[model samples]
Target chain A: MSRYLAAVVLLAGLAHPAVGAAQAAQNATLRRAQQAYDNLEYRQVLTLARAALRERLTGAERARAYELLGFTYGAMDSILKAVDAFKQVVLLDPERQLDPNRVSPKAYSAFDVALRQVLLVRQLRVDSVSFVGGQGAVPVRFTVTQPARVVARAIGSGATVVIDSGAWNGQVNLRWPARLPGGDPVPAGTYTLVVDARLGQNTFSASQPIRVSHGRVDTLPSVTSLPGYQFLPETEIPPQSWRPVGLAFLYTGGALVGTLGLESSSLGSSSKRELGLVGGAALVTGFVMMLRKPAARPAQANILYNHLLRDQIARRNQDIAKENVARRQQVQVTVAPVSPVTPK
Target chain B: MTRAALGPLLLALALRPAAGQLVAVGPQFVLADYREVASGLRYRGNGFGGALWARRNRFSVEAAVVRLSFDPVAGSAADSGFTATQVDAWVAYDVAAYASIEVGVLHRSVDPEFDAQSVGALRVGARSFYQIGPGATVVFRANYLAAPKFSGGGHAAVSLDLGLGLDVRLAGRLHGTATYAFNRMNRRTNPGGTGEIDAPIQETVARLGLALGF
Candidate 1:
């Protein structure tokens, strides 16, 4: 049993050094109380802690004194007295926590009981977010120690905007659109998000500082082309062939045949000089053309396709232009949590 | 027609300021062969002419006038030569990328009033054209002559004209053109109200020219 008691003292010593080192005691009696608790002198710790509570001390030191007494009574197996002392400890510093893994179960149970007996708001958080005005919301969350009437607000220099009000307990979540009653976004400035919880006459409030900023909403750029579709060449060069000469021969032959068939018997035969001159010229031109590079002719299919693609791009750009116009009128709202400052 | 009469007409057509209209005008050197009445009556000649072509959209108009002095060929019955003035005009509408339907008029008048037959006819025709090379095209046409009139007072039941043409763009705003035309008229006539006798006429002409494009 003595060994078990020593182990308990060791665990208690490991758990509390962090809290003791976090804040130095201003009062000599409170410092002695903390040293007696660390040394596992339960009787002396209780006496010094109670005497330190009677002296002039800072709020943190007074809470530490009560916490020392709570641990001493728990070690002495006086559970009821330990719970009472823990209640005083929590009432002074509602946010104080004892690690269950490091502290004796009796002491941790007493601290838990003290927390349930008080009305408090804890772990209030406002996450940083950015969105277009009137389109999104800010997320706020907190924990209530007991069932209470809770009210959340964002108080700025020029305005106090109520975020929410409810009878809530345990973990609570809320979304604040941050807009005015007339549907405009609230003015941009530094704000304090405060959550207050009340149970009968007992009330606790927690606050987080945040900054809201305004900026221009980004606009979309106009499109010059469509994805996966492209313009094609409107003209093409055909391959060189004897088609020109062949066609010339065909036309010349037809004229010759017609002239021979239509000549009158009485008129005998018509002179061939005119036909010879023109047909020879036609044949020579055809041969020369056949040797030359072919002309670029309209590629009908590609021309039609390019026309349609241009129309599509024009239509898409028109839509982007209209969307950018709408975006220009909307505001960008940025809400970021700032480092908290101590409240007076 | 005189050069003075044809000059202003071609000038006016070339100078017309109409949007989307293509116009070309030029002078032509022509070679012609004429045969009439009997095989012994044949003539050959060379002449000069002017031509104008204008097109807007699918419609086009072309006109050519030539004045020729034809002397009888060797061993022909004709003893003298004659001057003939011929005018041809056509208005065409494209029916396909390479084809068009056309209506036109052909009129020819003989000098000295009697050396050769002067004829007038309405032409109904269709032409097919193809682009053979860069700035080069070839055309062929067939026309039926209808309601023909002759200065010698003959009626022809069958008359037809066939043509072949080529145009090549030699340089900017300049083009080389050549055309061949062959026409035949099967005329029947009787002197002093006698029975009809077959008196046929045939002519062939080739025109080559350089044209300015606008």
Candidate 2:
């Protein structure tokens, strides 16, 4: 039963041979160390991995050497030494990760302990954003491996702007308004967002490149009229009636009565020929007019309503003009992440 | 009044370049009836005239001049006839949308000197006007003749005049006009301080014309 449990433990540790496949070593010693680790030769892995570490290697190969040493130590039941080796592995590549489901529990535990021991900022990200100046901010997120004093900054175009500074650990989120202390947006150009974490003698940083651009802020349009309101006609046609002919008859009758009453008795009755001629013409004109369409007259209520609507539209346009003027003086700011340059 | 004063006045009013001013000028055909003292002393005549009207703002002016030659009608007790020249003028101010108060003068002269009464009087009156249709109006007026002077020398206790008028715009800037007027004067004269005797005069005139509006 003891031998069977030993075989099961060896199979579990060798389950993730593909983990090192992507980092095929160019150096003969590191290649031998990786082969020995895959063969479950823990003693040979420890010797060969330590020897490969002594040789000058690429940064990736060096991290691979340390990872092999960590797994070899965990298979030999030396948890302290395994954790020490993983610490070196994470220091060489802060973003290095080991899957707990594919690796031995002991190796995964040591890797976790190594991550907790280091002071590093990992997975730094800057999300693309656009906003009117002073209205919004850019989103930034990262992870810190240990409790540390973390400072985030943007440096470019001969200027360095500090984004945030605090003592924090684990996952951290920040918002950068990308404005100056005077409430103005920064000049447009390519910039590097750098995050630094320091814990006593140990320190690590991560960086991302971002681009800032400027654009004209959209202005509001002036209104010509209000919604749901309209102007009405200022004149209306009156209804047709017999008032014209009636008035003509009344006036003619008045003239006739007055003439008859004012006649002098000595002169008897004056001739009616003059009255017959003119009064006949008046009566005819009046009768014709009564049959005609009435003329349009002023609509007082509609005129007043149209005047008020025009006033309201004028006021609205004035307000829009003022807002457009303000918008013309402001700027739109856009920020987006770009492919990073080589970090120093 | 001479034609010289009246002609220039009408010309100036027509030529004045004032906003909202209306001016109309026309020739008129006139029909008139005249009687003196007794019904038998009557004459009927036809004549010609000219009329001018101008309005600006709420004020208006109107003038008419006619010349008529008359002969006694059939069975009349008159041996001769007369020629008469009459002038009438008024200046009015609107008191309401359709009403106005006016002051004016009327003067008539006879060519035969004594064949008929030559009268002059100051007129004070009120008129009402209404628009019967598009570009059509009717007017009526009543006047109290005050301070009368007659060529034959008379004192008039009461005198009155009444008129009716019509204007229709027949076409662009062209108008048709018609007017009728009647006046009566009650005069008492003491010839050589003999006794008071009644001598009254009455006349009726009709005018029809076409006016050019500006």
Worst 10 residues of 2 chain A by lDDT: A14-23
Q: What are the runs in model 2 whose C-alpha is more than 4 Å off?
A: A1-178, A191-210, A217-235, A298-327, A334-344, B1-21, B38-40, B73-79, B195-197
Q: What ranges in model 1 sit over 4 Å off?
A: A1-120, A143-149, A167-172, A198-202, A213-294, A297-332, A341-344, B1-21, B38-40, B71-81
lDDT per residue (tens digit) for residues A1-344 in model 1: 99999887665654473355325887888777777767777788878888988889888887778877777788788888888988887777766778777778888888888778878787777889999999999999988889999999999985789999999998999999988778888899999998988899988888989999999999877777789998899999899999989988888888899889888878888878888888887888889989989888899999999999999989998988898898899889999999752321
Q: Global CA lDDT of candidate 1, please?
A: 0.86
Q: Under CAPRI classification, how is model 2 graded?
A: medium
What are the DockQ scores of the candidates, in order? 0.64, 0.65
Score residue B71 of candidate 2 by CA lDDT: 87
Clashes of each: 0, 0
B165 in model 2: Cα distance from truth in Å? 1.4
Number of the predicted model whose TM-score against the real structure is largest:
1
